[model samples]
Target: MDPAIASKVLPQGLRNRLSASVRLAPDPRVHYPGSDFPAALADAHILISGWGCPALTGDVLAHAPGLRAVMHAAGSVKSLVGEAVWRRGITVSSAADANAAPVVSHTLALITLAVRRTLSMAAGYREGWPAFEARSGADGRTVGIVGASRIGRRVITGLAKADAGYRLLVSDPCLADEDARLLGAERVELADLCRHSDVVSIHAPLLHETSGLFDAALLSLIPDGGALVNTARGPIVDTAALTAECASGRLEAYLDVTDPEPLPADHALLNLPNVLVTPHIAGAQGDEVTRLGRYAVEEVERWVAGRPLLGEVTRQALPRLA
Candidate 1:
């Protein structure tokens, strides 16, 4: 973690609790691998990691003979944890569960706006007020979830609890028909979900198999005037195909992530009236960061008490997880 983040996450009070429970590094901010980093790891039993923490490799682990565990204060340990850490039998935990809450909430809010055609309406305001018949209702609107991930599951739960009576459809390889029913959703193939959904929200991980998953053909399956919402990794959707869809005014989108993130200045998607392209702001940020900090602190507490980690990450499960 960066030094500034270390201070915010482990303010004086939490730092004291950590110190009382176990030995801590004199400085908790080890963001990079360097000579000083190895010396700092000497005699350390655990590492408190965060967003900027460097990858743990063989050379780095050689210096920390006593390290047994790592508690990360951020989501996605894919970049933070390497083969060396797992080979050493070191326990690892992530604060992804804490991070999922804000993403789900933000995504749901976007869905609400999308279902009502807020962007298209606002874009055409200068022309004239939309006729009553042109306005859409949220009631009985079909929403499709592309992945049954942590965030996806929470979004399904949110849809179930909403007063709008949304019809939920989910497409995930691992989700069974019974499981979808339990979540108040219908298990459908991706193409079927796209064909039926009024709003489609993506919550899948970025993997070799998932890259460009929403290409021209799949994206074309969406009904006219439908909206697409993406809070997941950018490459999962075809950037060029999406631009063409929104360019023709056939579909609307609320994209929090982009294939070429921070798309070029003249990118078509940036200027589209019906598309809401935001920098990735759906996850924890500002005040919400405290939740990740609190979760990491509790994980550390649990570890000290010899309890199973709440956010445990095993090497075998990494490929299937976000």
Candidate 2:
């Protein structure tokens, strides 16, 4: 883990628990992209990794001859793992599951607001209170989920159990009809999902095929006054097309991630009242970060006890992950 966030991620109390199970390195400091990094890994049997850790390239791995596993205290090992780690046959795990609860909760909150026309209605407040006929709620509204990825699945589950009586529709080529039905959703094609949904939430991975999926033509299919939510990657939605829709007040966008991400200071989307662009904070942050450290530490204990790891990642599954 990076020293900068070590206190929050692995505080003294957790460190004491960790110390009881594994031998603390002689130098209990941290480094990566530093002269002392290689020396730190010299006699390691297991590596506890997190954000800011260097990719385990072959050269870096050479320093840890006996390293058997890596427990990452963060989401997505895609950027941290490489061909070298897999070739060495080392076990790898991520704290993505632990990080997912917050994103799922945030996304669900966004969906609740979107279905209620919260942003548009709030924008209308300056002119005068919205008419009783113009107001709406989540009850009986159809919500489209773009991909049934890990976080997406949880969002669907949340919607399914809502008393608001949401009609759930999911879009993912990998989905089976039975799977959708079991999740209390109907599986549909992407265009069909866009055409009929009152709100479309993106959960798909950003792949070559998914890039710009909600292009001008498809975005135009969303009913006038509908909303679009992207808690996934930014490139999956066409920024220019989305901006035009929101600017016209014909649609609302709740975006947690954006294409240029952080967007330019003067981007039209930022100035739109009905469109929201958050700083990718739907995931864990603040005190919630402690969950990731706890998850990673638990995985370490499981591996040491010869128990099956709960969050293992394999080379074959990296492409499908966020």
RMSD of each: 1.5, 1.4
Candidate 1, residue 85: CA error in Å?
A: 1.4
- TM match of model 1 to true structure: 0.96
For all candidates in order, the CA lDDT equals: 0.90, 0.91
- TM-score of each candidate? 0.96, 0.96
What is candidate 2's lDDT per residue for 44-65, written digit by digit as tens?
A: 9888888888888899889889
RMSD of 1: 1.5
Q: Report how far off residue 124 is in candidate 1 (Å).
A: 0.5
Please provide, for model 1 over 1-322, each residue's C-alpha lDDT reduced to its tens digit, 9 standing for 90 to 100.
Answer: 7766666666777777778788777666545544377667888888888877778889888989999999999999999788899899999999999999999999999999999999999988889988999999899899999999999999999989996879999999999999999998999999999999999999999999999999989999999999999999999999999999999999999999998998998999999999999999999887677778788889988999999899999999998777
- Each model's number of backbone clashes? 0, 0
User: Where is model 1 more than 4 Å wrong at Cα?
Assistant: 29-35
